[model samples]
Target: MLRISAEDDRDVAQFQQLHEDAKKNGFGRIFRSTFLFEDMVKSILLCNSTWEKTLAKMVESGKLNLEEMERRDMTAEQVSEKLKKLTGFGAFVTATVLMCIGYYHLLPSDIETLRIFRETLETTAQSFYDRFFPFQSLAYCELSQLDYKSVSGCSHIKQLKAA
Candidate 1:
């Protein structure tokens, strides 16, 4: 994933090509939108319901207002209970809220920090996966063997030949 970060010269070239490839594959949005907030209330509600049904209900009912809850002196437990009243919300959603509150304080307030932390976790995990898994390199070699010569340009291939 560091290769996707455009740090190394080879990575810059590869990332550019990858950008083009992603555009060709109709997936440019996947790379473009990096930081996305999970709408906790919507996610909770959609737990068992179809996404379309959940969205329709949400549009009809309006968004959950955390500020209103706070103004009403409602605690996290109260808010979680309110969410569970919605169809599809269950023990999992309530448990998630309890866990998140315990670990990180609360929703909205911890969102930015959580986003950063999650990004860090993903990057770290990807690095570990890359180090442990030779699947990518092996796949590239197989592609080269199949006459897709661009597989020779794989970063692992270049690194291996340099060694």
Candidate 2:
């Protein structure tokens, strides 16, 4: 998990490559956790539903090898599959956990994502963020940050390029 933020240098480089404005306004990273399992638990608790008992039982019974995920050997797809196998983990939960664990290729799209994308990108379409490739989730986070800040007088994400 330590390597996650250290390796973000590459993501930052891609951020610049995707948009020069990214270089002007530095990206803000919210610290999720020092361990992948910790992040999985935290994101799961915060995202939606009451899967706490299920997750707790799985952990207590050793049915879920959350620590092994910290090895960082597993691909995002691999982690997603394992998480999806969890009894209460739906698409959003799985994707949220992956994102919190430093996987940026997936989006945990929900109503908020839809509202922001529609207002900011002016589209109800999907895959419009494909240009960001594996960094799409981070890009979405940035867009949301912009939208919120704009409500308080900062520029919206759509105007971020010119900001």
Candidate 3:
């Protein structure tokens, strides 16, 4: 589903290449959920917590009736409202779940992710979104693989200094 189109410009090509290389190196594919409720809860746990903490929270939360959530066939708005009721589920977390559930237009632009974009790409979130748009998440995933030191020393920094 995440294929690189022949018509896509240089940015998409870069992302596609990075994603392919990562796959070859045995990086696991991004996680998605068949059950909406599970994804909703996972998104909540992902907020302001480590992956270990997310797992621990899920385990502590116990069994959920994913079938019921599916059966409800709730609208994105409804699901967002429900997520808001949970502790620690903020606007960004709610947006993340919505995005995970196939709303590609929304960027789950939290503080940390924004900081990474600023540091690495040297761009504002709105500008980054304007350029990358639907592929922003894919770009973020690829960029996340870079070492901080290497990124800091990247040629872009040299170009910026020259300018």
In angstroms, give how far residue 4 of model 2 lies from its true place: 5.4
What number of backbone clashes does candidate 3 have, counting pairs of residues 3 or more apart or in separate chains?
0
TM-score ranking of the models: 2, 3, 1
| Candidate 3 clash pair list | none
Report clash pairs, candidate 2.
none
List ranges where model 3 is wrong by over 4 Å: 1-30, 48-72, 120-163
What TM-score would you give candidate 2 relative to the actual structure? 0.61
lDDT of each: 0.46, 0.65, 0.56
User: What's the TM-score of every candidate structure?
Assistant: 0.29, 0.61, 0.40
- Could you arrange the candidates by lDDT from highest to lowest? 2, 3, 1
Estimate the Cα RMSD of every predicted model relative to the unseen true structure: 16.1, 12.4, 14.3
Please write out the lDDT profile of model 1 over residues 66-117, one tens digit for every residue: 4444343566668667767756556665545443332122333235556776
Model 1 C-alpha lDDT versus the unseen true structure:
0.46
| Superposition TM-score, candidate 3 onto the true structure | 0.40
Top candidate when judged by lDDT against the true structure: 2
What is the per-residue lDDT of model 2 for residues 77-146, given as tens digits with 9 covering 90 to 100?
A: 8888888887667777788777666676777886777777666554312244566889878877887788
